[model samples]
Target: MEPLGRGDPRARRPRGAHGFVRSRDGLYRPEELYDATPYSTSSDARAYQWSSEDRSPDALLTRALHDESIDQALGRWCDPRKLVGVMGGHAAERGSQEYADATRLGRTLGATHTVATGGGPGAMEAANLGASLAEADDAAVDEALGVLAEVPSFRPSVDAWVDAAWRARALCPTPSPNLGVPTWFYGHEPPNVFATSIAKYFRNAQREAILLMICDAGIVFLPGAGGTVQEIFQDACENYYATGDKVAPMVLVGRRYWTETLPAWQLLTALARGRAMEDHVHLVDTVDEAAALLNRPPVSRPSAPDAR
Candidate 1:
């Protein structure tokens, strides 16, 4: 046979002169890395050895679910405003007080924002779920819940994770839109189902960068782990340089977390004191304060003729 063309069926096969040939075992493939066929009862004991190996059902299901989620997220991210990310720890449990706080934040933002998250449990789920619950209209809430109920908290089994999410949605309907920008690298924590949509990624770094870039107003950083810290610095760098189309506000929530936990508050304060970035940063303790800072009108620059 001639060399495989790019558009040819054989092109999909492994390249080079290693032509397809049957092995001694009667398998019709050179790369017989694994036995992947069924053995009949009439076959000899040796025949069973070459029989196909079955992959773990759970693993197969998880992969399929993950692929589907990634595809869904990709579709959602096409519209930037459809996403609003919330970065926080996956360790936050379902019923914890911290989870409740995160949920409250989600609700407040969800009322006006699209409400996006890292798509795992804890704070992510709390925020999405809160937004899902804040819907005043029953029918609209039920529709949203039905859609999100497909995937619940991240778990060992994709089936369970998806089922739980669907259950949660069924239990609490939502009229507003929410999203989860989860990562397959952290696949153990499935995307929260409460999110109306998802924008999952293979790389956390790329996912985070995209999340920060898309937020028109800016992100709100709650207490979190290394991931949250990384985001804080990244956001600061963007603001300091005025990297994007406009210099959006970088509002840091939780004074204690910024001041004590990470000391970012101190760093931002020092940077602001330098005059170059005096009005760029606003460190606050409450959501209301952060919202107000974001909504404040921009100061107009003096015209050159007027200045002279």
Candidate 2:
């Protein structure tokens, strides 16, 4: 099927001012939009607390506003050609080797491309934290990781998780602009705040599709489970049919992870051969390899709304 938002005029606008204030100094507080609780405790994210009534009317309206506003802000600021996406598990905790590697990738990618993620904790937050710490030294990463190690996972407590992330940002204060597209449909997973701009929505399907559409440069897959596997084929199918004038790279990081552990690399490769997506597929061991392959030439726009 054709990707959603094809020939969308609103998707074509280039970067411009969004509806709210953004700071290049440090990670801004929870996005102050339809909901003021992005900075509040994680428990505040649930729809149940949205209004004096049930989480119905008010919550629904807020979601509509967020969807529209997020679409606008993304079009105004995103350059799909320079956008790189990293998909991975939401379980990778701070101080782990996996988290460290993902962070390193984010820092390096931040030097050129604007990093984007699913906007949750685990590997996603680690990548965002990496880009945020690029200007600092490794010691900064360690110190910040120490802070995040407090909760380790957002599953335990979203509030604690975000508190740790905010503390991490304060300790480092590295100014790297990143984008996060999260959905409230997965209410359990609070949106990660590593990105300077967050386009949070209520529709999971729209969020998933937009996330893939905006990744014109390419997407890197780290170790993950069912959801990540679904994404691999979703992107592959799009490439097989050749979306737009481009078939963005789909590089899998961690040879062992993608090959033996998750075993999606072989399937991805087999699907690519003799297909339009053949050249765009790659497999490597390190984050640097993933970034290098993904940053190569011919990264083109998708069939989605073209940004100005």
Candidate 3:
């Protein structure tokens, strides 16, 4: 379970090579997380295990450096403000109606904007899958869904799950580019393969904030559990005090789910009262409605200073 570092005898690249520092690193492709094949145990899995077992200085340093690299890589990806984020529970099974809705939501949003997700299985994977095939026809999307339905969960075998997704991807005419931000903090849930570029981190807090911050285009939250609830408010908190043109639309799909089942909307609306975000928050029943709200004419704002 040893990580490749300064003391590793098999090392070829120096410490300044990609992934060791901010300057040298680049965004990760799904294949970069694997040792050899997509079916094999990922470097992320191995690193998580090593992190849990080792509390040494070097181990801590490795994690820190990796996170820094991810931050740098993210800068090269795209304008964060243009990214539309999809958040939901990881428990939604492949064949379930909820999974289908998330996928459709991603597809709709991906048609106009770059889609970003938490990069785990279930609804997150579903959304990323849809975004990747945004340019393809509806039949292709349905076929991919059918292929994924074979393996509902990744619990018993991640290999089988990944194999199915790879097969599904082969059906796409032109896979669109998308972003995935997964953290090793929740190591049990592996990152999905659908996202073209990944910025994986070791810190969950950093990952969460960055995900919310980058989605200035807005976030569409689907039915989810504790993590999803936290994200709703976290984004709300940012919007609450934000000035003109800083408020990003917050669309929560599943009216009953947000109003009755989880009841986050009640408090969310209360929080947005008398604020600039009041007009920006919405609760809708369908993914199409959510997409419509997000796809509305962009909010007029002052020009930001050039980056670079």
Candidate 4:
């Protein structure tokens, strides 16, 4: 073993009789310099070098934090007039009806508005892919799919995800820029390649929270699991409290899921009937219906009386 560094008390040891003999080739004799000051210094240098070379953990964390910041910045760029977000499960499989439906929804929204997502595969990829392909020429669509073909699914390498997205850009391009707010915590689920821009984050909670906060236009909820449930409640809380930018509409895509399966629609309806939350909730069974609800103007309320 060797002294850790210059600040270490053991580093002050005296040199040996041969003044710590060194080879002409610049290597020191191990035994002669074991307890020597130069040896300690060398140990410290090696330690420093090792630390510098081992940046995997720090690099991953740094990227995660950067993703959070990027998401916030992208949220700022979204035009509330035309920005629409879809919330659903990441587990949606490629080529499934749910995925295809979600993609069609994205394509419809992309024609006239910007579509946003959590930036992973399944629904996210479908939407982005739909939008990208819907707007591009056939040749462009082919190129775009080629780029995305590298990582067509979520459970794969990050490089594949990134490369696919880059290639897609060369093929089916966006008429209007869109955003992807993904997180490094779920690094396995790479951001969708179809998004014109990305807002990646390290912290899942912060990413989810911020996403709900900035979706001022509205949110369309699809069938999903834990993460989706979390988002639904977070949005409900915001609406319940009349938080920032006022409460936007909450659109549920599938009637069965919203009304029967999870039954969030019933819960929201009950809440809305109460004095504290009246008129703040709406439920729709289809995408067209959801779109109509989203486009409806905000309701007006009587102003509070002023104190004399």
Candidate 5:
């Protein structure tokens, strides 16, 4: 490939990009690096790996501005009012049934709603992959999923993992409606290749809030650890406070995983009892059911418990 940026007209040369060039859709592809370093490639993960000098105070401000600009651009690409997020563990991997189920949910939701993600691997990648594949057809998704099944995890090495993903893309280069909101704070985890529209940020807090706020329709929660749990509560807290004037659905994908395994679902539902967000809190056995929850109208935000 003729140096990723040199030959491609689409490669942007930003005025104050600070080593990060926000491309037409995905993360910036650094023009300086030779060989396919993470930053040089279009991989979302590379956007988080800026050198110390590149992250100097002056550069950080510029990068922050660039991230904001990218978010502005994304607002034009899809209706923020129709976004539905899929939240889950970044370690879910490719071949597992959990990953496969997430992919199906993305395909289902992406057909009618724009799929949003935290923009990392595991379940995030599976869902974004599904949304992208859905742009073509169901058979295309099946073929790509088979290719990914051969090399399931990126933890072993991103090179082999990325290679398999590229092979799948070559087989099915469908337009993707998956919007990824990733941050440099978790750069080691690399942004998954699936989201065609990525909003990479330097601030993790802002990214998290934006991901939850923009998903107007709802969010789907998969089995996860601390971070995912934190997200659930943060989102719930916001809806409880009616901070944004609207509260969306919060659907848990695995019934057993949410109830028996974690029990966070019980806590959330209990808190939501007799409240407006109650109708929006759903526990489903399949991806289809989760998608169905989004397809319906969100419940009104009832009067929250007295904060006093």
Candidate 6:
């Protein structure tokens, strides 16, 4: 499959106060990351390589600068209060019910809010795919889904998986924009292509924090393993410390899975007790219910901190 272009010419570089340097180097555009043959030569691959091998002070400084640049861009363009995040496992295959549910959740939320995710494969990719096709009809979405099912997972071949997504992307030429915060730390899980705007970082901790913080409208936790659980409590901690007006809703889908399987809901509910976030926390049976709960007016805007 043919890769995308190297960079976005449409992006305006941020000029320095002295009008000499372009201060904001900016994050990799979707095209920039995907462009090249054999995935190894792609910008995503090269960036991960550098992040993995580098240890010099200059490299650290550059990584910090790059992440800060991305933060500045997000600040200027996206309304953090309107961002709704979806957190789930990366193992959900494309044709699976879990993937389909995440996709529907994203489409529904994307109708009103900008969908955001961890930006890797599985549920993250599904949500991004749904958001991208938010403006399309059901038939078009179904067609795209069918196209993606050809390559369900990124395991055997990430290139094949990406190609399938690219094929699916054609169904919605003018895709609804969405945000993705991926990290190089998890290099095994390549970033998905459906995220129109990707804010990829070298540090996973910074990426996770930024992803959770920007979802001011709140986050919907899809059934997932360890990573999803971490997001739930991380978001809960933010809401737990937030004032009454600043607390964002946290909706967890799959009551039985969370309560019986993982049993995180018990602790989550207990933690919400006697706090401003008590009423904001909810347990739902489906993504439909989660979307409905988060469809209300947005809470106070949460601050988006720089990666440094």
Judged by TM-score, which candidate is best?
Answer: 3
Model 5: weakest 10-residue lDDT segment is 26-35
Local distance difference test, each candidate: 0.56, 0.69, 0.83, 0.59, 0.73, 0.83
| TM-score, one value per model | 0.62, 0.78, 0.89, 0.66, 0.83, 0.88
Across residues 1-308, which tens digit of lDDT does each residue of candidate 6 receive?
11222464423443222221123445456777888878888878877776787676666666666677777877665754489899999999999999999999999999998999999999999999999888899998899889999899988998899889888998788999898889889987999999998887777898898889888888999999999999999998888888777788999999999999999999999987767788889999999999999986654443433222
Is 3 or 4 the stronger prediction by TM-score?
3
Higher-ranked by TM-score: 3 or 6 = 3
Clash list (residue pairs), candidate 4 = 64-202, 67-200, 68-201
Candidate 3 residue pairs in clash (backbone atoms < 3 Å): none
lDDT tens digits by residue: candidate 5, 1-308: 11244556645544343434533343332221112654336334344445323756656665666667656766676554478899999988788888899999888888888898888889998888888777677788888889999888876677777778778878764566577777767877766777776776777887888888888778999889887898898888766666334777898877888889888998998877766577677888888888888887545654666562
Prediction 5 global C-alpha lDDT: 0.73
Instruction: Give per-residue lDDT, candidate 2, residue 252.
Output: 82
Clashes of 2: 9
Q: How does candidate 3 fare on TM-score?
A: 0.89
Summing lDDT over every window of 10 consecutive residues in candidate 3, give the lowest-scoring window: 15-24
Q: Which residue runs of candidate 5 sit more than 4 Å off their true CA positions?
A: 1-47, 51-55, 243-245, 301-308
The C-alpha stretches of model 1 lying farther than 4 A from their native spots are 1-84, 137-164, 172-174, 243-245, 272-280, 291-308
RMSD vs true structure, all candidates: 12.6, 9.1, 4.9, 14.7, 4.3, 5.9
Which TM-score value belongs to model 2? 0.78
| TM-score quality measure for candidate 6 | 0.88
Candidate number that wins on TM-score, 1 or 3: 3
**Stretches > 4 Å off in candidate 4:** 1-68, 79-82, 133-152, 156-170, 243-245, 275-280, 300-308
RMSD of 1: 12.6
Model 3 residue 49 CA deviation in Å: 1.0
